[model samples]
Target: MDRLSRFARRIFALGAGSSMALVFLVIFVNSVRRYTIGKSIAWGEELPIYLTIYGVMFGIAYAYMTDSHIRFAVFLDMLEEKIKRFVLIACDLLTAATGVTLIFAGHAFAMRRGSVASSGLKSTGDWLAQITGIPWLEWVGKVGTWQYAIVLGGAMLAIAAILRLSERLSAPSKAKEPVAPLAAPAGKAST
Candidate 1:
């Protein structure tokens, strides 16, 4: 399980990094073209938006897997150790629930948008088909394609949350230190 989680984390990182890199390159080249030749690639604007969405979605998963996401720990710190553990478990459950919600919402939205198409992406598909010599690639530009990122992100989040909850539950609880009196003994009182 540990190894699998590591592998998943790596995949998430790669997906996010690659998407960001591609988005940057496309936007840069398009900007250069627009400035130098007064023309922009048809897919430049559309492609970057989709890439950014994918990048952000994957990055969220990567963050969750790596325990890099932010948490407000001030209140948690005030709780007893055992209560803290339960609270953490509850938080994980909530996160998993949210992820599940996203999964359903994203799936429904993607399905509904399946028939909708983007002209810019169609042009992109045509260009890609010409360059790659794949005749069928011309139909690759569906608006619903990028919407699947929400599903992917949600799945990753739910899985990571479940794994974390399991690990937390299986781990041995820490022994709390015995509380000492606030006031020092007469012999040990401060001068």
Candidate 2:
């Protein structure tokens, strides 16, 4: 399980990095074309926006896996070990619940916009389908924005939250301290 989680984290990081790169390339090319050629790709703005949305969504999962997200540790740090463990468990439970909500909401949102075809992606999909000769590729070729935003992002977030909760629940508790024997008063030494 640990190995699987690590593998998943790596995959998420790769996806985020790839998306970020794509966005950067698209924006750079669009800028160059507009300035140098006095013309811009009609779909340039939309494509990079979508890629950025996907990148940020996947980045959230990567952050969670790496434990790099922001923490309000001022109060938590002051807690006793046992109490801190309990508090962490409670926080995990809350995060899990939020993930579940996102999953459901994202599904519904995706479904609602599933039939709406994106103008920017539709043409790109058609071109790819022609080159690849894959009929089913066109289906994803014309996906709605919600499919990228809610479906992919929300699903990844939910999965990350669940994995994090499981890790917290199964982690071993901190070892207890060894207590020293109490000494008798200096003037009165008993048997």
Candidate 3:
């Protein structure tokens, strides 16, 4: 399990890094073209927007895997150990539930958009279809942008939540160690 978690983290990091690099390169080239050639790539902005979506989706997973997501630690620190553990477990359960809800909602939204795109593609003239040589209806029918971003983010969050819950459950509880009394200083009378 530990090995699998490590491998997953590495894959997420690589994906996020690649997406970020692609976004940066696309924006840089587009800017150069606009300034030097006086014309920019038509689809340049679109590609970067998609890449940013992918990068942010993967980044969420990476943050969860690294335990870098923000939390109110001060409140947890003030709680008793057992109470803290209970609160953590509850939070993990809530996170998992939210992730599952997002996955379902994202899937539904993607399917609806795909259906709309497919219908629009089917209504286009043959000449346009022949010029593009794209199976637009079929392609749009199969994939949606939401699948790449929201669905992926939700799936990662769910996995992270489950892993956290398991780790918390398996960990051995630690008892507070007794503290020793401070001794009198050398050559000084005891209080």
Candidate 4:
């Protein structure tokens, strides 16, 4: 079980890291081309867009493992120990349900549209479509559309992590902010 968990974490980190790196590279290349060449690179925009989407989508699993997502820790920190556990369990269950629902929705939507025609992709190019050979990229052919589904799967896994870890955790410390707020004037009501 421990080995499996470690492997999963490694996979999550790799996916997120690759996606972010790709996104950055694409953007950087586009910027260089745009200014140096004095014209937009026709396909440059889509690479970053898709990479960002994939990176963000796949990063959830790792983020959950590290408990990095936004949380209501201010409130959780104030609760009694017993009450905190109850709230954490409730939160975990809610996350799991939410992840499952998203996966279902994504899959259903993908399947319904699978057979429908997709116009040629711009910017990033439908590399997925090209892989199997489709349109003009006869050499590449049509690509698989299963990747987005995988992203949804990762999110569900993240939720699973949350569920598994909830019972074992102490309430997390609140994150500190560098800039303290200035006090409002005594007579004026604060917004």
- C-alpha lDDT score of every prediction, in listed order: 0.85, 0.76, 0.74, 0.62
User: Root-mean-square deviation of each candidate, in angstroms?
Assistant: 3.7, 5.1, 4.7, 10.7
Candidate 1 lDDT over 91-179, as tens digits, reads 88998898899999999999899646776798777778899999867655878777888998898889878877777788888669889
TM-score of every prediction relative to native:
0.82, 0.78, 0.77, 0.64
lDDT of 3 by residue, 12-115 (tens): 78889999999999899999999999997765756677678878878877777777778898988899888988998898899888888878988887877744
Clashes of 1: 0
Which one is best on lDDT?
Answer: 1
Worst 10 residues of 4 by lDDT: 138-147
> For model 2, where is the 10-residue window of minimal lDDT?
139-148
- Higher-scoring candidate on lDDT, 3 or 4: 3
lDDT of 1: 0.85
The total number of steric clashes, by the backbone 3 Å criterion, in model 2 comes to: 0
Using TM-score as the measure, the top candidate is 1
Model 4: lDDT to the true structure: 0.62
Off by over 4 Å in 4: 38-41, 115-163, 166-191
Model 4, span 49-162: residue lDDT tens: 656666777677777665677888999889977787777767767767777777777766766654433232332245644664565542111122433544366465645566
Where is the poorest 10-residue window by lDDT in model 1? 114-123
